[model samples]
Target: MKRVLTTLSAALLVIACENSKGPELTGDKPPETAGDTSEGDSETGPDPDDPPVVTSAGPTTEGETDTGTTGDTTCSFVCDTTGGTGPDIQCDNWGQDCPDGQKCAAYANDGGFSWNALKCVPADAAGGEVGDPCTVEGNGVSGIDSCAFGSMCWAVDPESGQGVCVALCTGSPEAAQCAPAGTTCVVANEGVLNLCLPQCDPLLQNCESGDLCLPNPLDQSAFVCILDASGESGTTFDPCEYGNACDAGFVCQDPIFASECDPGAKGCCLPYCDLSDPECPGANQDCLAWFEAGMAPPGYENVGYCGIPQG
Candidate 1:
């Protein structure tokens, strides 16, 4: 809605300028010279010969977004009947414990972008099923999207509210799962974005759209594609917490797994290497199996990490 209004405002300005011009000097008077700055109207104010002012009360459509500045509160609600403040309508994201036509979804209520609240919303919006293009009702945090039953819109553009439907992780959070074999469930944003993300090869790092391939958080056996949140400083031995926090060819490892890592650090970035030709950066270190015996997915059996191998 903001986008539309801004566009409309621009168009209106163009039309007004075109209308305000001195009627092209059609009848008798010759057209003014190019540098003629005759004091008809100053650049700072409206034109004297401009047409009647045009105004729009609001959007013609019933549902339009109110997304403002980025720092403005993203914490919006779908059921804020109690004057935009009330107890959250929590529900099971896995079970989707809502009425027959509704689905449970996570959202935010605090000032930040994290999904710290839940709500049940009607599922009769727009796009349904996974991978479909969709839109959000209010802002992105409204928890009311155009996806049906078991999916929620992901990768939403905050201003436009446009996104794609992604399947919510099924089963319990502890034992979360996805449908397709190659896709892994990704639980993120304080568990609001529980969707199936595609798996990738740590060696090849063949993720779509520059996403990083890292070890699956559910299990370290295989790699999964995730959005890279590790900005410029993602180099070797960089202290990190999340697996994707490391740049490409590196994965987050505990101090025990990362040789010479800061003794008190929680985790650090380490390189992945081919098991067939083992290599390590530190002295006496060896590329060890990242996953347990016989656990790596097919074609990725040779994936290993540089670490101090135990005898």
Candidate 2:
């Protein structure tokens, strides 16, 4: 259950990588190659126009794609800019350090929309508890959310200031946790947001209405439902710069995994599948493990990506 913070909520994960803003994290590239490709038919063989690509576990080099676009902003930046929300008034998010009836919260300080600092803000004395419908004041980063202490307003409607109250992680960063069982605490937005997002199954795609199941921004070890920032494109083999830039069931993968993908592109979209039902597009592609051996969490052992098998 991760909630990425951006100037625009719907455009949250669309991380525009300007040096002044977003931090780089392996260039948001998803899982890599599954196997070696042998020359064969259209699906299994390299495309006539596209050449083979060298695969490796590293951040992609900054450049343009087949669509002739770069600086693609479609992932949350794990920023470290920690300026206080207000002058000489900082508060601890783990502890209710603010005066009674107030709570510690995060807000943007760099004239940007994402939260990078913490401060004391008024807590709704009569506000609903976790999972209750809530409202935010000013904007999402105003920190004037009408959520109870230890919770924050999430999924907010920009125009209406309406949203739901989600639980914040309880312990310190080293031992951060969610009180709710089965919930995963995702730390994002410069560590200002320690959200307790719900764990979900990647294969089922069983998230709420608009959100889609994807690996958490912090790590791919667990599955969490994040907003669908796939936008209008993110189709198969579409160039992507981040893990969340692809449409549902697709993730940004290395070009070597897909025969039709442009090797020059930073990354391309590939499908996620089950080991029992391998629906990999290419003839040489197979549903391979998304994580290293014994690295996957329980229940996620079968999670696989469509890619060429590794020898």
Candidate 3:
């Protein structure tokens, strides 16, 4: 019985030893060596040595790098109220959102994405007519507005002689729908190039003999003489109710009848000598008789036979 029990104990001890070796064989791992470390890798996740990404706010083509963001844009609207040309889209340096005919341009508002309505600049020696539109670089004006940021030009009328600079709005060139001739909307200070002249009173007979009585260019309601500074009249005087240029010795005593003699003409000194006549109330009888008789003379129509002095 003793021997058999010893044999069972020995078998049990061998089984226990086998069970202990199983865990050592299955759970064991090789030791990490110094060569196992890599310079291009990180223990956390992705490698830090990778290149960075680039992006921009400006426009780009398809397949370009984009960070997935957007920007704003600006524009303008212009149209001719007159039945001339149709609406046109042009580029200019005016603020965005102007009335019709205005252009789009950069302004203080918005982040530089707007339109500016371009205006005509004044005409210089090289510029167009006073009423015609022009740009700063001497280009003809066409209404345009845009949203570009930079130095821009405007069309304007330059002043001449004595005329003032008058700004113009949209209108027809053939008619005064927008502005009068010789006048146009332009940059400031352009009116100095306009001609200066005296405005004649329309109520009076402003037309001098030989002077063309024309409508005032500045104010249509007024009258003005086309004659130059020298009072001499021109060959063709605008049709006056009654007037004509006179000889060198004659004066415009009655502008209504510019050439005909007044009652107190030197050829008829009696009128000048008449007591009731305010010109020469106290003329002598000899002077009066001589004046009347001179008028009757055949060749004395332009003769001087009065008390007045003649050079």
Candidate 4:
């Protein structure tokens, strides 16, 4: 099913990162050999102490796949500008062997069952810049063609497999990364990931004439500019596709209450408020904290919604 964000009236949240559940990288092991024997020793057997070996038919090229051979074993390596034969060690082992300004990271395969060979990746802003289209190709691994070190690829349209590289920033709004004049840093995934998004103010309608300043799907306190919903102004309990679809003073929230939306349902619109407010939409609704205490920036304790407290 297609993935979408939904919201609950009382409390709703969403994460910018897609929940694709890719495999996580763990410890490292010696590169596998093409031929294996139970005896563990053969003419093609690799010595455990030897550094990983790489064999390429010709000169290594950046973003190109090459075969790395150690003894009889063969593994694939994505060449970078480092010009190194192969990673001298796995990221889990000793430090990265990539050239200056680059780091090593183990990338998991698209199947989410295993990982490809370790490769050197830029440790700084040497690759794709923010807002560049990126694809999950080579070896079918996520983050393979990852953006520059401080950026991540966000799937803008899951069905079309279209994504854009966004720059990561710190959690604090004031300390967030510097961005273009019209944009600001927004907390995309709480403490996990932050991104530079267009600056907007929902209350002032500071966005473009037709755009809306809506709470980020990942964090209610953070706002971003998005296109105006085509139909009538959204109200509480109205279904919404993006947070910006809601009318002024209302936000699109996941229906699951304190959780993200289900894959299909985008969510319903809800009003946000400060706990200091005296009244709510209904008697059953009460002001409840939306994010954990430490999860949000300072002065956010009063940020909440008039809704049933989530368990």
Instruction: Judging by lDDT against the true structure, name the best candidate.
Output: 2
Residues 67-178, candidate 4, lDDT per residue (tens digit)? 1122232322112212332333233212234577764543432232122334556554566677787544342233355566655554323234445665655333334443
Model 2: which ten-residue window has the lowest total lDDT?
A: 1-10
- Among all windows of ten consecutive residues in candidate 4, which has the lowest summed lDDT? 22-31
RMSD of each: 23.4, 11.1, 49.6, 18.0
TM-score of 1: 0.63
- Per-residue C-alpha lDDT of model 2 across residues 94-119, encoded as one tens digit per residue: 66578998988866554444454578
Candidate 3 stretches with Cα past 4 Å from truth are 1-81, 85-164, 169-199, 202-213, 216-221, 224-234, 237-311
Name the best candidate (by TM-score).
2
Q: What ranking of all candidate models by lDDT puts the best one first?
A: 2, 1, 4, 3
Q: Write the per-residue lDDT of candidate 3 for residues 92-133, one digit (tens) a residue.
A: 222223444333321111111111122332223332343233
Compute each candidate's TM-score over C-alphas. Answer: 0.63, 0.69, 0.17, 0.36
Model 4 misplaced stretches (Cα beyond 4 Å): 1-126, 137-141, 170-174, 188-190, 201-212, 215-222, 225-235, 238-249, 252-268, 271-311
1 against 4, candidate with superior TM-score:
1
How accurate locally, in lDDT, is each candidate? 0.48, 0.53, 0.19, 0.38
lDDT of 4 at 184: 51
The deviation in Å at residue 129 for candidate 1 is 2.8
CA shift of 13, model 3, Å? 99
How good is model 2 by TM-score?
Answer: 0.69
